[model samples]
Target: MTPHRLGIVGLGVISAAYLETLAACSTLVVTAIADLDPDRAAAVARTLPAAHPMTVAELLASDDVDTVLNLTTPAAHVEIALGAINRGKPVYGEKPLAVTLSEGRSILAAATQAGVRVGSAPDTVLGTGIQTARAAIDDGLIGRPVAASAVMVTAGHELWHPHPDFYYREGGGPLFDMGPYYITALVHLLGPIRSVTGASSRPQDHRVIRTGPRAGESIPVSVDTHVTGVLEHVNGALSTITMSFDSTATVASPIEVHGTEGTLVVGDPNTFDGPTSLRRVNDVGFHLLDPLAGYVDGARGIGLLDQIRAPRRGIARANGELALHVLDVMESLQRAASQGRRVETSTDADRPDPVPLTPRSEWLAVQH
Candidate 1:
């Protein structure tokens, strides 16, 4: 098969990971690079044999590009996605699909009308960490999954990120920035959320940058710094989640799922792979489970590969519908917190088909 040409639209911190992973894959090729800063795009382009720097508009309309990789910030997600869609190109984007549920819906609606595929990230769920735990649940080791808890805590991004101002913006709070990984993993392990109830707080009005060149500068916080919520899944399972930028640290497992006869301690959802442990009701202690499913040694760009292969496989695991649903869940949670009432989700996405154990050799091999 011919390699699918990709036009990458952002040159942020996350783009490096995607570039590293895609460079080794034969099924995809970087054809164009674009960013808000021309020099950055040109510098990145100099390293790639086939990629050339282009303006965002030029890249979106370029005939050499078969697909668009929308890695711009949350605020620009809708604009970039719509630009690609209008030009009749399939698009794979970073998480939250868009900052607002309405913007997310617009992306999907445009894709449907354009007859192009839409894919979204936090594809970490498609890796061994979550998939192995998913296999355990399906094999009845945990019997019937009844509940789950996901926790993410940190002092805030300002300590490390060079441009940390976005973290406190409307689309960049703890719940929006880091929540997709946890929530998307929950959807993969459990099911789609039907409703949500939440309570949130913004403890600090301003935060001091501690790491970058702007170390002593302060950034205003416009969104919630801490968020706690309960998600009621369509299958009747419940998941409690806590996402916070105000907390320092914790010993809690990133995620834990309880079932009729056992409990599974899942690895961090943000990572591609980690340890998954299981403890039966009668067992002396938790036992580490071998990797049972998913892409081995997977990384960021694997989801885009999955999307490209969806034609032959019949489904895309890290798809736009799932991303849109995850976005809806987050938006609904925020609404529930503000209104002090349970909010039902306005969107739905079926649990994607579980990934079977797939080695790097096989997954990375060029598909004919």
Candidate 2:
């Protein structure tokens, strides 16, 4: 099969991670890159195998690019995606799809108008981490799932990131920011949500940075700093979600799903190699598993490290592909919520439902 050619629209930190993922995605290739900052584009260009750096316009016009990897910040997502779709290229976009639900709608409408496929973010759901867990539940290892919960708390990103202003603005907050990962995982495991009710606040006066040169800079808040919501799924499963940029405290047990037979402790949905643990109410031991199944040698690294090592993980060669699927679901959920209707999603229309696997850490081709 010919590899899907991709053109990336941004050279930010997130795009760097996407570039790294291509090492293991034998089916995808980065052929072009564009950024308003020529230097940033040049830097990203140097990292690719044969990438040609150009303006977004030039890249969009290139017939060599079959898909757009819209990694631009949330603010530019709508414009770039619209451009690509108008030209009949498929898209796999970064999270939130756009800075506003309105913007997301426009992008989706454009994709629909142009008859192009659109994929959205927080692809961690498709990673072996979440997929493996889904398989287990389907296989009856955890019996029938009844409830689940997820947490995402932080001190905010104004200090460490080079440009932190966008995060504190509207369209950027705990719910929209980290919400996709939690929501995407829940939908993947329990199916689409029917509704969500929530509370929000921008109560923090200031936040501290944990890393980088401006690590101690204080960031003022404009958007909601804390958010809690209930996802009422169609399958009668419910998910409790809590997110905040108000604290420096860490959260344990990123996700937990309770079922008739046992409980599953899931890894963070933000990355793919999360460990899954199952134990019945009266069980003596926790059964540990990696959602990636036969993929990966069972190493659990948290945060951006998963992105860094995904291309090299034993069975995570498919991490980038999984991310594409995850991006699709996250985009659909936002569109569903914004459009006041549930989305019917099927990019890979013929894909099979996941089959559960017994707990094991079988390794696959690590590299090469």
Candidate 3:
């Protein structure tokens, strides 16, 4: 099959992961790459065979490319996406959609007006860990889901990130920076939020960089160190999301869902797939549900993030597929505030083309 020509913007470390994952698939080909740092772009291009980096304009203008992957920094997502949308090209962005809610909305608005397709990150919801959990809920294995909550507490990105400048910028707060993964998973499993209310704080005065090229640099904190939001769902289910980077502590439960019959413990949404376990106390009392062994979409999403270094051949088409579903959730939320109406979605948004997530052949982190 002829592969979809893909052009990726931004050559950050995350792009390295995408390259690794893309090598495993064979649906899309990275025709070109673009980055503000010409040298950085050239560096990534050298790793790929015969594919060199180009300017954003050059990549977009190339006749060989069909899809534009906006892997730029969070703050520039809206501008890059709008540019691609104006050209009537499908866009797949990294995450947070944009630095601010207004920018995110404008990008969505432009895409809607142009009638172009747009996708965003945090594809881990489609991972077998999450999908397995979703399947159990659908089958009433967990009973009626009553409520959900997620806690993401980190010491801050400055400790490890080479360039930790963006995370502390205006749009670089705990909620917008690291929120997509946790929140996306909730929306995928629970449905869109109804009304949101919460408080945020910039709990830190300064940060010391511990890793990367710039070590021991003091970074200023501009946004909230932690953001606590309460999500009220249409199904009468309530969810609490607490994000913090000022504290170096782990959560008792990173993610948890409560229902009439049982509870589901989910894995970190940062990865593609994982072993998710469920525990339930039905009429027969409490028992741990078997570790779901199935092929899931998120594992495949690694390919999407890495399509440049190692190119994939064709597009994956599947209902409830990882990429498309996550994209819809993010896009819907981008415009959700303005709608003043309920936004509903399902796993059937896109046809799973790459391959349907199936039960894995062996058990690893997830077990019976």
lDDT winner: 1
TM-score of each: 0.99, 0.78, 0.81
Model 1 spans > 4 angstroms off: 366-368
Where model 2 places Cα greater than 4 Å from the true spot, the runs are 1-3, 205-220, 290-368
In candidate 3, stretches whose alpha carbon ends up further than 4 angstroms from where it belongs are: 282-297, 300-356, 359-368
lDDT of 1: 0.94
lDDT, candidate 3, 1-368, per-residue tens: 56667788988878876676554445556789899999988888887664669999888777777778778888788888888888877677787666654565567677778865566776565566666666777778778999998889988888889888888886676766777788777766776555565666676778888997789889888766777766766577888888889788985677888889888877776664655667778444434455453344445344233232122333322111343344444334433433544355432232222223554331111210
**CA lDDT, every model vs. true structure:** 0.94, 0.65, 0.66
Question: TM-score winner among the candidates?
Answer: 1
Clashes of each: 0, 8, 30
Angstrom error of the Cα, residue 207, model 3: value is 1.2
Model 2, range 236-330, lDDT digits (tens) per residue?
A: 88787788888876655888888998899888888766778888878898888744452342322111222323435432322223333334444
- Superposed on all Cα atoms, the candidates' RMSDs to the truth, in angstroms, are 0.9, 6.7, 6.5
Please, what are the lDDT tens digits per residue for candidate 1 over residues 39-72?
9999999999999999999999999999899999
- Worst 10 contiguous positions by lDDT, candidate 2: 359-368
Clashes of 1: 0
